[model samples]
Each structure stands twice: as structure tokens, then as C-alpha cells.
Target: MIFESSETSGFPVATPRAVPPSGRRPGWNKVPEVTVYFWTIKILCTTVGDTAADLLKEKAGLGLTGVSVLMSTVLAVVLAAQFRSTQYRAGVYWPTVALVSVVGTLAGDNLIDATGVTVETASSVFVIALAIVFVVWYRRERTLSIHSIDTTSRESFYWLAVLFAFALGTAAGDLVSQRLHLGYWLSAVLFGLAIAAVGLAHFQLDLDAVWSFWTVYILTRPLGASIGDYLSRPSGDGGLELGTVVTSALFLMVIVGLVVYLAATRVDVTDPEHTSRHVA
Candidate 1:
């Protein structure tokens, strides 16, 4: 298993984080339904993204730029398929997410390692970029709900926001966990606590579901990255010394298993039509 904790890692919780959501969003599209299965696979994807990026860059002898270019190309091809599809297909959607996660990790990594950018600077830049994406998205679509991402423009915005969240999470996670010297396991715990607090606010305090969902989504990227490092880094580095290939393979296996199940069961597929609203 990935962890000894109550929850393994982070991702968007079941739809909206509300106790009893009155009006569900209408229609499904190119994404999985928000459910336990969805989060499980999503978390795995993040962890694998972290480890797989390492394997590609460090182990496979693909330099940072090489891995970035390679994965970006793959992500572009997959995204084209995803955008072309009118409906959600686990086969297409999850691979795109996995690729995006890897590429996102590389994006943040290149900023710090290739250039001389500080994690703090990269983190701040990503935050501003993400905010701009949201602003443009909300202005054009009038809603920020993932459930409403049926149209092409909205889907584009959704993917862009997702990419930024992963990139920002990568920078922020590295800053707190690595630059701050908290170490991997500690960083994982801290980020997990933050995510848990968000969960509490959403369920108990009536925090807006859409905001809470996105908050969790953005936060999980780092939490999973931390967990990945904790598992894969050398024991001399205060990690389990599992190795990048091992960690990546293990998490990838779990993700594939869960995705296959969800594909067959369709448990995470959303309704064709319901009523939901995001940031107003």
C-alpha cells in the first residue's frame, strides 16, 4: 500500500465536498466522475508523476529538457484525443492526466534546476498564472465547476487550470518540503493535514464546494509528490530508499488496477444532466 495513514494521498474529494448537495451538475464529459475511485487513481497518478519524472530524467538518461520535450509531446497527442472525444473515456482521460502530471512536475523542475529560479519565485509565478487562468476562465465561462466542462473552451480552460495547479503544487511542495528542510515524510504529513482541514471546512463549515474541490485538487499534487519522495528517495536522505522505478511501477500498477475497475463499473461516470453551480 502507499501509506499507513487514514487517507493515502490527496486529490479532489467526491463531488463538491458537500454533505448533501442539492443540485448536482448537469452532464458529463471528458473527465471521470468525482468519487472515491476517482481520487484513488488521481492520487496514484500524482505519485507516479513524481517518481516517473525522476526515472525518465535520472534513470532513463533523458536529461530534464529531453524528458520535458518527450512527455510534452505525448501529453499534446493525448490531449488532442481527449479534446476530440465528446464523452469521458477512462482509457483516454486517465492517461492524459498521468502525462500531464509528469509534464507539470517537469515544468516546475526545469524552472528551478535548469534556470536559476528559486522555488519561491517559481511558486509565486505559478500562483499568479493560476489566478490569471481562473480569472479568464470565470470571465469567459461564468462558472468554474469541473462538472460544466462539456464545451471545448471550458475544457481548455479546465486543462490549463489543472496544469497550473500541478506546476504550482510542484514548486510549493518542493519549497516547503525540500528548501525548507522539512524532509519528505514530514512534508507529506503537513500537506495531508492542510488537505484534511480543507475537507473539514467544506463538509462542516459550508465552504463553497467548487472552491473546496479546486483547493483540494491543487493541494493533492504536492501531498502526493511528498509521499513519492518519502518513498523513493535514498535512506540516507531520510526516505525508504524504494527507488524511483520501483515506486513508479508500484503506483502505476495500483492506478491501472483502479482505473480498469472504474472503467468496467462506470462507478465514476457523472449524470447526463443535473443542476450545479460553481464560483458565481
Candidate 2:
């Protein structure tokens, strides 16, 4: 994978071209460029996923099973639209990500609460599952870079990896905060530092760009979840007591505004030239 240092994130940004198998014409890339906005919206979606799930279960009184079914159904519909679209549309893409976040969080919760699985076991299982997805994806396509996510097969692998990342992140966050008793704010700090360390390793220590990107991506899930918890949990619980409803609404509004801006501007579309460059 070809990369250049990102001005915003300090980590290497992928600029690889995708080569479709012979006899296939390449299509428009189905995901955004790895711009600052991409990371911003991603973290926002993760935070929303963490709190919105709780809000639905408690305020809407849907309970865990009901919320899981409702959100999973919604995510399936959104993902269907995502798969059908010829290219990335901020409206369709971000909402699909947000829904996946919700479903992923619920999946982790069910595994722990209803099934009586320990957090460590759940985390380990998700890690193994994610590794398998990555192995299969890389073996088939010969690359794990998100820059090449143009075809349906690659897109399927991308979403599968994303789902497992979210699930693993939720389990890891819960394990640290609840089991280890680190509290929400401290957990957020820990994960944030972890992301920074990943960046430092990539930029200063010559880490592989693809591995660096995926590491930061997985770490962001727990970081955003911890931030959500820190903001929404009561003061006695070492939070600001903003409440999940307030936190979800506030973040959702910001996310909507940014998505609208991106839709109008088309600033996040992956450049076709970058793909061609890699192929050449």
C-alpha cells in the first residue's frame, strides 16, 4: 500500500489503487477518503452507537432483545441500500455506519448479559473472528487497505470487519471500565493514549500503514464508547450526568450537520486517480 503522512492525524494515509480481476471494469470507490472528516464522523458514530443503544433500551423500554431486533432490522435495510448504491453517498453511508454501531453494541451486550459470557472470553472470541475475516479478505484480495473497497466482495469484507471491530471494542471497553474498575473517563484516556501510541509507532517507528490504520480504527471504538459513558453516566458513577438521551441527541445533531455538509460538498469522495496510480 502507498501512503503519505496525514496533516491532521500524523499517521500514514493510504493512496493505493485498486486492481479488479481481469475482465472487470473498476467502479467508483464506495467509501470516503481517509480525510479528517472520515475519522470525525466515525468517532461520532461510535459514540452514538454506545449511548443510543442504552437510551432505546431504557427510555423506550424495548429491553435488550427488543432493541437488538429493531436495530438489527434497521441496519440490514440500511446496509441493503448501501450495497445497492453505485458509489458513496454521505447520507446512506453514515447512517449505515451509525446503525452498524448500534447493532454491534447490542450484540456485545447480549453476549455478556443474556448468554452469561465473560467479557474476556467475548473479547477473545471477537478478536479471533476479526482475525479470520482479515485473513480471508487478504487471501482473496491480496490487500487489507480500505482504499480498495470498490467491488461488492471487498465491501462485504469491509463491513464484516467493521462489525467485529465494534463488537470487540465494546467488550474491551466494558472489560476495562467495569471489570478492571478504571471508570469511564480513565478508560477513555487509556484508549486515546493507545491510539496515539499507534500513530507514533506508524510515523516514527515504521509500522505498516494497513496495520496502523486498523489498530487505530479498533481503538477508536472503545475511546468513543468511554467518552459516551463519561458524558452520560451520573456523577456518582464518575460521569457528568448529561444522560444518554441528551448525549445521543447532541452527538447525532452534530453528525447530521456534518453529513449534510459532506453531501453538499462531496469533499470526502475517494479520488479515482489514486486507484489508477496503484494499478499503474
Highest TM-score model number: 2
Clashing pairs in 1: 24-275, 26-274
TM of each candidate vs. truth: 0.88, 0.93
lDDT of 1 by residue, 26-85 (tens): 464567667777777777899999999999988667799988999999999999999988
Question: What digit string (tens of lDDT, one per residue) describes model 2 on residues 36-76?
Answer: 89888899999999999999999778889999999999999
By summed lDDT, which 10 consecutive residues of candidate 2 come out lowest?
1-10
Q: How close is candidate 1 to the true structure, as a TM-score?
A: 0.88
Off by over 4 Å in 1: 1-26, 275-280
Report lDDT (CA) for all predictions.
0.80, 0.86
Residue 151 lDDT in candidate 2: 79
Worst 10 residues of 1 by lDDT: 1-10
Question: lDDT of model 2 at residue 187?
Answer: 88
